[model samples]
Target chain A: MIRRIAFNLFAWTIVLAVAFPLFWMVLTSLKPQFELFRRPPTFLPETWTVEHYWTLLSSTKFLTYFKNSVILSTTTTLVVVAIATIGAYSLVRFRYRGRESLAFLVLFTYLLPSVVLIIPLYLMLVQLGLSNSILSLVIAYTTFALPYALWLLRSFMAGIPEDLESAALVDGASRLGAFRDVILPQLLPGIISTALFTFILSWNEYLYALVLVNSDSARPLTTGVMNMLVSSFNIEWSLLMAASVMMSVPLIIVFAFLQSYLTRGFGAGGVKG
Target chain B: MAEVVFKDIVKSFGSFTAVHGLNLTIAEGEFVSLLGPSGCGKTTTLRMLAGLDFPTSGSISIGNRVVNDVAPGERDIAMVFQSYALYPHMTVYDNIAYPLKKRGVRKADRAPMVQKTADLLQLTELLRRKPRQLSGGQQQRVALGRALVRDPKVFLLDEPLSNLDAKLRGYMRVELVELHRRLGRTMVYVTHDQLEAMTMSDRIAVMEGGKLQQFAPPNEVYREPANRFVAGFIGTPAMNLIDGTLANEAGAWRFASPGITLTCPPLTDDAVSGPACLGVRPEDVLLGEGPIRGQVQVVEQTGHENIVVVKIADGIRLTGRAGADHVWRPGETIQCAVDVSKAHVFAAGPSGQRLNRPLTKDQPRLAKEGA
Candidate 1:
């Protein structure tokens, strides 16, 4: 009886430790400016107002950033997932000279730190006349996402036995037909969550966006949120906090739904390949 | 109806040859099995016939048409894999119906064909369930049903029953043979289990290191194995082979080894004399006072038969199949008899390839009791 109580207490302590900051953020976001800075931290504010949310809506480009994020994340996810699924399938099924070396090259690109590529990428974008375009961001984001997604999806595709494809072929399907009818459907789960992962990663990314874009016309939420944090000397803590929390929402939702398969993507599909 | 022929079929992965000029012919409506261990290229040959993998330097023809360049779908062949390969996301009905639909069969004609296949395999009730919901035996039937619904000219099975339990495998063995007989389809099966090849196939093609060792009727493969590889691979508890020299002794052929002198059968002419291996099946090597003697080293009982491992001269462990009724202890000196008439004599070939030519029509062959 004592052991059970002790175990429960220990587990709850760990949970509370991790969840406390998010709890504090929510409480502070609901409080007025003065209550937020109160000497004694208030778990629950005496007076909660929707003013901070209202201020974010009316005074900031939070809505524009939100829209940009949605468009960028969704489109990036779709394109990255599509390309990775095909790339992964090709890497897994088609054997050609230097296939493993090709796959290794892609992984090497992913291993390159984004910070190191920022200057060269900026120079290329400048040369290509894509310096301030969202298309440039999409292209840049895909460079990082493609390799990790390819490796993950390759492992997933590898788990599905080649026999399924051969069976379909023997059953009168051409090679592509077998892939479409049999192999692709089996890989849907892996592709779905892999896309979500890439989208969320690109969505929350700030370093590349801040370095690449020069205008509000193309800035995504991550770059826009950095704008919210500036005042030369005085940071708008309430506004910055509100936008940060809002910017995190989409990523949280994507991660929550795709959490199950994200862990399994590498472990299940690494065989056979 | 298609007669599948593999003519000098050779497949190589880079410089490593998996199949070396394998030659075989499957008559229309014939059931033949390719039996070999892993990496022996039985599966590769089956895939070549199915047009999944291209052969390196050989021609394959199905139904008199050279299908070396033909696509798998156009080859009119169906394959059931050891993994079953049923689509897990699809129901049994969807899986079985998928092939027919892909083949562009009329929608109006697909339902009855799928139903017929389902009924034939006794899978009608489980059609709505996904593959993971079904048992291994049921999944195996679904794999067969998927192939059967195509109504192809040939059926290829690559160790289809290997995933099933032993008891279910025995049951499905008979079921598969009956299905083949009922359909009269040209079916090719591959397995490492010799018993499966012997019991289920009309003809067996024994392979070793990608080369076709022997292709003959199952009874012939069991009794008249052409070489040492087939002789050792085809029988359970394996055939006993004692390395010895053949010489003329008093106008009779004799196989002389250290501490063991045995008479060779008459087919072993003086011209056939050489360093040879005396081959005898465990069942043919009787345990009694007749010629040889050995100490019983181990006795294994499988309810009906006793497998006695005897320690003979030259540290050669000879297996003796005896009755379970007569129980014996280990370390006991046992009188053993070598059925001289049944012993097969073969001149040693390259690295254990014992040479024993197939007897001519007029030549006397080894008897079951003597072999």
Candidate 2:
């Protein structure tokens, strides 16, 4: 009984340790501006108000930034997943020289720190006349997401038996038809997971969004939040925490529903004798 | 239905050859099996016939039209893979109807055709289920139904029944032969199991090391193997091969080894008289009173007959069948005999080609009765 009590205490301590920041953020977001700067922080708000959420929803720039984030992340995910699926499928199925090295190179690029690419990507966006545009952020996010997406999806494609495509060919379907009809359907889980990962990465991204876009017309939520931190000397803690809570809701909802597909080997029962 | 011919086909992957200069003509309405061990290029040959893998050189013609440059989709050949390769996301009905859908067949026309195929394979009850929900045998039927729905000119099955249980494999073998007769289409099957090839194929092409060893009807391949490899490969428990040298001793043809000698059947004048290997089937290894002496190693009773394993000489073991009524034990001395007429003599070389050609059409068994 004593050991069980000790184990339960340790587990709860870890859970509360991880969850306390979010708990505090919610409490602070609900508190009025006066209670936030108190010397002794209030564990729970004495007076709750929806004014911060109301202000955020009413502000036109906040809505525009939210829309920009949705557009950039969605476009990045679709483009990255499509290109990575095709690139991964070709790398796994077709025979060519330097395929192993090419796959290794993709992984190498995926492992590189994203900070290393920011300056060069910024310069490239300027050259392409896409600076200060959402297109620049979309292009930059895809460049980073594509390599990891290819690496993950390639392994998933390899698990699928090669015989499925060969059987499709022998059944009088063309090569592209076989890939579309047989391979792509089985790769659905991998593709979904890739899309989720790329979308979340772009949604949470700050560096590329800050350096590339300059104005409210093209700014995403990440840059918009950072702009709020510096635009006023006295930071609006309640408003900032409220915006942070809203930004994280979609990711939580995606994970809650599609969590099973994120587990590896989703194609297990897809092929058998 | 169409006849498929592979003329001087060679398939190589970079420096290594998978099939070397293969020439085979599969007639319409006939079933031929390419039988060999794994890595002997049987599956590669079947893949080439299906146009999945193009040959490194040489042309293939189907019904007198050369398909050298034709893609697999345009070739009109249906294949069943070893893994079944059923479309897992689709139901049985959709799986069977995919080829027709690819060909732009009307949806109304495809339903009855898929239904007919499902009925043919006895899979009508499972049309609504996905492949993962079905048992292995059911999955196999779905694969067959998928191929049968197309009504292609040729059917290529690459070890289709290799994944089934033994009893189900036997049952499906009979079903496949009946299906062939009902459809009367040209079929080419690939398998490593000799029993599957022998029992199902009208003709068997025995291959080894990327080359054809012999191509003949099933019984002929059994009775008159062209080389030692075919003789050793085609039978259960394997044909007994005893290495010896042929000599003209006292003006009589004889084969002599370390501990045994037998009168060799007459060979043609052109046959070489040097080192040779003698082969005899297990059932022909008579185990009564005979000149050859051996020690019984083990006796196994397999329902109908008992298999007696005997160590004939140093490191040479021969297996023969005895009646279940006859009792034998391990470490017992036994005398055996072989009917000289049933013995096969092969040249002792890397090729192991048959060296003995019988001089007459009819040759009686020249061993003592009930020896």
What lDDT does each candidate get?
0.83, 0.87
Query: After superposition, which runs of candidate 2 have C-alpha atoms over 4 Å from their true positions?
Result: A1-13, A260-265, B250-252, B358-361, B368-371
Mind giving the per-residue lDDT tens digits that candidate 1 earns over B1-371?
A: 49888898889999899999988988999999999889889999888888889999989999999999998888888888888888776788888988888888888898999899999889999989878777788888898898888778999998998988899999999999998889999999999999899998989999989999989999898888878788888898899887878777777677777656776666533235668787888987788565567889999999998999887776676788989898878999987777665667777753254444444557664432311
> What's the CA error at residue B214 for candidate 2, in Å?
0.7
User: Lowest-lDDT window of 10 residues in candidate 2 chain B?
Assistant: B362-371
State the lDDT of candidate 2 residue by residue for B219-301, as single tens digits.
Answer: 98998889999989989878888887888787766887755688777665645668888888888888867887899999998
* Candidate 1 chain A weakest lDDT stretch, 10 residues: A264-273
* Candidate 2 docking quality: incorrect, acceptable, medium or high: medium
Which structure among the candidates has the greatest lDDT?
Answer: 2
Best candidate (score: DockQ): 2
Q: What lDDT tens digits, residue by residue, belong to model 1 across residues A187-257?
A: 87788778877887988888989999868878898888778668689877777777767777877887787
Question: Which portions of model 1 miss their true places by more than 4 Å?
Answer: A1-7, A255-273, B249-252, B268-272, B324-329, B349-371
DockQ of each: 0.45, 0.63
Of the true interface contacts, the fraction found in model 2 is: 0.72
Q: Judged by TM-score, which candidate is best?
A: 2
